[model samples]
Target chain A: AQTVTQSQPEMSVQEAETVTLSCTYDTSENNYYLFWYKQPPSRQMILVIRQEAYKQQNATENRFSVNFQKAAKSFSLKISDSQLGDTAMYFCALSGGSYIPTFGRGTSLIVHP
Target chain B: GAGVSQSPSNKVTEKGKDVELRCDPISGHTALYWYRQSLGQGLEFLIYFQGNSAPDKSGLPSDRFSAERTGGSVSTLTIQRTQQEDSAVYLCASSIPKGLAALPSYNEQFFGPGTRLTVL
Candidate 1:
């Protein structure tokens, strides 16, 4: 079984600054995927970014990016130039094949002006 | 033509009452998933279905919880003798499956507006 861990229970970032939410996962399978999802006050789960295990190049989506170190079993998300809109609960997840998804406890991010 | 959708945006039931949550996945998506999210907690995997086959049932919390996919489309998760621990937001997601040539990506899940279940 694979388990994902998010060390930070809560994080705060000033607007226009950057913040990183750390996550680590334990998985035996070599072929897998890692993701960051954001849930706002509305409670809608939105995909932030994704990194394929096979790809050494990190995944970047404008303001959101991931630092995936397959060897270390660590995958962290970075938010640049944070905005008030970025305030939400972030989750780290892992999956190999069509199996069940494993999620970390999640980190609550607050962006203040 | 639409994204995933779930009915009864909120459900409140007394203990021992049975509740059924419905999910309508994105059109033409063969893969569907059910997950539970408690307050201030991560998502808990519940069940997954590919087409009509459930290759994994390891996530279901207990025998009282069961899910079924019909016509390779809609899905329903039923909780019998509901317990307070069962109270959470039930989320449903859908994705396209890998076919003979096209391999599916693991991320990119289209989620529906979840059904919030409150068991008392």
Candidate 2:
């Protein structure tokens, strides 16, 4: 069984600043996918970014990027130049060939103006 | 293009009653998923459907929970004899699946605004 863990329950960052949310997972599969999803106040889950375990290079999507360390089983999400709109509940997930993802307890992020 | 959609944004039912939640996946998507989100459990996958067939239903918490997809488009999750512990947001997601040989590159899932189910 694969499990994702988000150690931080809540995080806050000032507007224009950066914040990094930590995530780690345990999986026996060698090839898999890791993802960060955001759920806003509207309760809509949005995909932030994704990383393929086989790819040594991390994944980046504009302001959202991931620091994936395969050996450490760590995949952290970094938000650059945070904005108020970035405030949301962020969840880290792991999925293998099965395509069924295991999600972590979300971390609530607040961007203060 | 519209994303996935769920019906009855909020449902409140009493203990021992049955509740049904609906999900309409994105057109042309062959894969659909159901999940439960709560403070205690966070987010947990409940079931997965691949073109009206469920190859994985291991995540269902108990026998009280069951789901089915019809015509490979819409899915319904039914909970029988609901208990207070069943109170949570029921989420639905859909994705286009790659060929069986290319499962690693399966497309990202699109999610719907979940239905909040309250079992009192």
Candidate 3:
């Protein structure tokens, strides 16, 4: 079984600043995918970014990027130029060749102006 | 384009009653998933459906829960003899079916707003 862990329960970032949320997972499978999802006040889950385990290069989506260290079983998300809209509950997930994904306990992020 | 949608954004039921939550995935998406989010359990996958393959119910917490995807599109998660602990936000997600040559990005699962179920 694969387990994802998000050590931080809550995080805060000043407007226009940057914030990095940590995530780690335990999986025996070699082929897998990692993802970061955001859920806002509307309670809609949105995909932030994704990283393939085979790709050592980190995944970047504009302000959202991931630092994926396969050897260390770590995948952290970095939000640059954070805005008020970035304030939401972030979740880290792991999915191997299967159709289901295991999610971590979300981290509530607050962007303070 | 319309995104994934779930009906009855909110539902309230009494203990021992049965409840059904529906999910309408994005058009053309061949994969659909059900998840439960609560204060104690956080987020947990309940079931998954991909194309014509057998749905995965490994994450379901108990036998009281069951789900079915109709015509490979809409899915319904049913909970029998609902308990107070079953109260939570039920979320649904969908993605393109994974093929032998499918890219990782194409497998991204888009989620619905979710249904908040309260069992009192």
Report iRMS (Å) of candidate 3.
2.9
Off by over 4 Å in 3: B98-106
lDDT of each: 0.87, 0.88, 0.89
TM-score of 2: 0.95
Instruction: Give per-model CA RMSD.
Output: 1.8, 1.6, 1.8
What part of the reference interface contacts, as a 0 to 1 fraction, does candidate 1 reproduce?
A: 0.59
Cα TM-score per model = 0.93, 0.95, 0.94
Report the Cα lDDT for candidate 1: 0.87
Ranking by DockQ: 2, 1, 3
Worst 10 residues of 1 chain B by lDDT: B98-107
Name the best candidate (by DockQ): 2
User: For candidate 3, what is the DockQ-based docking class?
Assistant: medium
**Candidate with best TM-score:** 2
Candidate 3, B84-108: lDDT as tens digits: 9999999999888567766323468
Worst 10 residues of 2 chain B by lDDT: B98-107
Of 1 and 3, which scores higher on TM-score? 3
Native contacts present in each candidate (fraction): 0.59, 0.61, 0.55
TM-score of chain B of 1: 0.91
lDDT of 3 by residue, A1-113 (tens): 88999999999999999999999999988888999999998778899998989998999999999999888999999999999999999999988856678899999999999
Error of 2 at A52 (Å): 0.9
**Residue A56 CA error for candidate 2 (Å)?**
1.2
Q: Distance from true position, residue B63, model 3, in Å?
A: 2.3
